[model samples]
Target: MGGLSSEENASSKSTSILLQIVEHSDGSVSRPFVPISAPSDDRPDATVLSKDVPLNPTHNTWLRIYRPSVLPLATKLPVVIYFHGGGFVVFSAASTFYHGLCEAMTGAISALVVSLEYRLAPEHRLPAAYEDAVETVLWIQSQARDPAAGEPWLVRHGDFSRCFLMGSSSGANMAYHAGLLATALELLPLQLLGLILHQPYFGGVERTPSEIRSEDDPILPLQANDTLWRLALPKGAERDHEFCNPVVAVPPELRHLPRCLVKGCEGDPLVDRQREFVRMLEREGASVVARVDQGGFHSVELLDPIRADSLFSEVRRFICNDL
Candidate 1:
């Protein structure tokens, strides 16, 4: 809803300051609005159908679903509820990048993909994203209990028993929080079988080698990372609030977490922390599979088709793997 500020107006493509959402010299705020892509059934591998469905009219939360067209009769596919990554301050579920990603995921995994569009921060802030993520799981459970309240695609063809929660970058942060909450929350027929965290965004007061070295990376820089936390986290809250620096300590609830797959990019600043997360999960005795791309940068999978195919292949394998 916000437009470009004076500083952003002057230096958009070549911004000098660390801020992605700029605060102008005159004290006005400006953040770039993401372009939304229309749902289409024209993907290359499969004719993917998609539509937007509101979760809660009051909170302005909603989801976009993507599913393959050609399916055998009486067949119900596994479900993937995805959260798009934008540092929790930018990006949209309806963005073309996410649409393409969901299309690939749906085709590769043969699953129903529900991409969530939750409230962004600087306006709504930290726990808002966390709360909405948890509410999405709860919302699905509600629909399962009452068919009249559910969406047609889910009610007709979605298999709640095989549902998986997935997200990339900061959205992965949301997925982690939600997955932790799901440990205690009751969802009858809808079981959370796994979690897929790709290029998870996490930080701490002490800088790691990747963060110290990646000063001006094209996709995500240390300053930009700090700025996103400043804008998204609770006001005056430090980055170590279990949500941001998850690897610091393993909580008891982790024992109840479903099997998890963590994807990390070698060229990403956050890769170290992602590795640390895997280590923590391991120490906690959680069932986990971790992958590190040799040379890929953060979110390159969303841009490059070959990379996307490879990444989605891994995702499909993770989701379809028998425990």
Candidate 2:
């Protein structure tokens, strides 16, 4: 009654919005996933040069490359093939969050970064992104097998023999898959030195300790996680499908995968699955560096500067040590 009619105010308040992706008892209806594109080549560092180039014209698949402006003479740097996390539905390679992260990582590690822009799901679906991930590796292998076919940034200074696949969330799922393929296909003269997964995304139908406990936490919630699987997983695929939960069956042999560094958070609903994955890796005799942040929530590094610094510093240590 302060300035508006009581009936009008009541109607406005009642119609206020809630869930971004709504799921009814009968069927689910999700909002369209529109990505925010960051300015091209408008990165922070003056010395770091960045640009976007298409990998496949048919699918419009592309990647953003980042490198130092002034390289130390005769010094070959490690190559990092990075994939961004969005639950496989939202965000993109050109998003400002990944842009800043890649720039900082390139500067800190003194390495070449190639951020893959894989297709989002609920539109493209599971194996689509996985296929793109594999293709990116093949692209690198092609470049290494013949320098003329390589991207300028890589051909000039990247050390393909020491390449690493780094991803977070759903992208982590892709990184693990791509690593498995690298082992089987054998990209000669280009060795995959390591796999760095920041909060590796894996899930199952059965409730785990963290999943049962941490429902509806800020960054990743239980209901949201379910909806993501619904959208990300291929049509008719179950929660325990091999793509979502590798601990099940696909890729019967985990051998040939390089050492891995998996970062998880106790406060995250996904951490329990991450822990299980580490154990599976151990059983397979694969070397793993499990770094769990006490009381840390999911994707804290995406916003908090201090947390981002700590995450990147940990990543730097893993990469440098592997080299």
Candidate 3:
């Protein structure tokens, strides 16, 4: 009753409201895929131009890049390497929902957006997505080193020194882990300024109060969340694995990492865990900014345009001034 008002959920509900989990004999899982959005760069009316590039040719992973149509002569734009959320088991950079998201982000934040299409589970699992995330950053670094070899958008106007990682839901989880890995490696010339985690998906064997209150909610029910973790985490791993629960998993080296902005919604089942995560970040001596919406559900920005714009505004503030 306390989470996701009925009206809010109703606006997004459909025949596929509940994610029907199909567990495979090989320990993999499947779900109904949403409609995909293709990349575009020739639209004269559009403010942002988007195109896809191969990130890992061997693994079939690619990244979708979004940049403003008009170039800025005075200053290079900050780069935002983004990851889309689908509980690590669904969605892609090409998802219709995320395409619009990156486009809006590109225009509003005035930053070049690169949305990674990483390998998902139960096909890839855990560190696989995390591995791809770090690799994507490395690819960007390589591009920065050789402008001719990189996409003109990145080389011409993108600011490599002010790079940021932003992701939603499970993608946010990947951003956190990958940020840690990238920082530890000391990848030179390409600096990480900050991290943006939107309603991050974190869990544990024990339920938090928010999870309990929204166990039956249509949008991301507790059982659905557990199934996702089961299919995403390594086999035999519980929700307590470092990948699922960050409050207990932050590394000692995280003390000097880039600033982090963690945003959540009160109607989300994961809000309590996100709050605890923010506290943990503070306790660990990390610079953190936390914003919680008064009323909304998980990934509410994706469904509500006004909420999405509000989020974009906050992200703009964070990228332009806060960070």
Which has the greatest TM-score? 3
State the displacement of the C-alpha of residue 113, model 2, in Å, after optimal TM-score superposition. 0.9
Clashing pairs in 2: none
Model 3 C-alpha lDDT versus the unseen true structure: 0.86
RMSD of model 3 against the true structure: 4.1
C-alpha lDDT values of all predictions: 0.82, 0.79, 0.86
Best by lDDT: 3
Off by over 4 Å in 2: 1-19, 22-45
Candidate 1: how many backbone clashes? 0
> Candidate 2 at 185: error in angstroms?
0.8
lDDT of 1 by residue, 34-138 (tens): 567987755555578888888878889998888888765887988898999988888788888788889777888799999999998877888898888888888
Ranking by lDDT: 3, 1, 2
lDDT of candidate 1 at residue 292, scale 0 to 100: 89
Candidate 3 displacement at residue 304 in angstroms: 0.6
Q: lDDT (0-100) at residue 66 of candidate 2?
A: 86
Give me candidate 1's TM-score against the actual structure. Answer: 0.90
Query: How well does each candidate superpose onto the true structure, as a TM-score?
Result: 0.90, 0.87, 0.93
All candidates: CA RMSD in angstroms?
5.2, 7.4, 4.1
